[model samples]
Target: MSLTLQDVKRVATLARIAVNDEEAATYQQHLNGIFGLIAEMQAVDTTGIEPMSHAQDLSQRLRDDVVTESNQRDKFQAIAPQVAGGLYLVPQVIE
Candidate 1:
């Protein structure tokens, strides 16, 4: 499938984009080229090809999950103005 100048104009109008004739023509050419590439890609047979997640094979380097900091919640909550049932109370700002 290819895009005509009229198609480009109509799409631009629907999208509320301000595009002049020259820009619309350029967009039409670029979109038609993309469609041509898609058509060419679809024409190739890949019946026996397995789908790949990425172009290059790579593995994620990860570190071991470990607790590095001691619990400081009790010390912080002791300085707050309101504390109830192990939770900080705040003023209701909304109804």
Candidate 2:
């Protein structure tokens, strides 16, 4: 679980962070602590435990699916800066 200076440098490069020597040493210590915690978690026995999305036992209410028609095309198109043939238009980008 010990993190080296090379590991800190690699992590800093991957995260796009500029790290000085002192900062790199500090981050090495912090990363070692985090890895130690992960090692401890890996040692725990969870053989029969079921994976769950939430910690609490609660059911989420969902509405029944239904399709409906909407007729607000003109109302919505009126607010557009540019519209043509029931569609919004934008400036051309690629040349």
The candidate that wins on lDDT is 1
lDDT of 1 by residue, 4-95 (tens): 89999999999999999999999999999999999999999999989999998888999999999999999989999999998999999999
| Candidate 2 residue-wise lDDT, 1-95, digit = tens | 68899989998999999999999999898889999999999999999999998999899899888768678888889999999998799999999
Single out the weakest 10-residue window by summed lDDT for candidate 1.
50-59
lDDT (Cα) of model 2: 0.92
- Report the error of model 2 at residue 68, Å: 11
Residue 4 alpha-carbon offset, candidate 1, angstroms? 3.6
TM-score against truth, every candidate? 0.71, 0.58
Ten contiguous residues with the weakest lDDT in model 2? 64-73
lDDT of each: 0.95, 0.92
Q: How far is 85's C-alpha from truth in model 2 (Å)?
A: 16
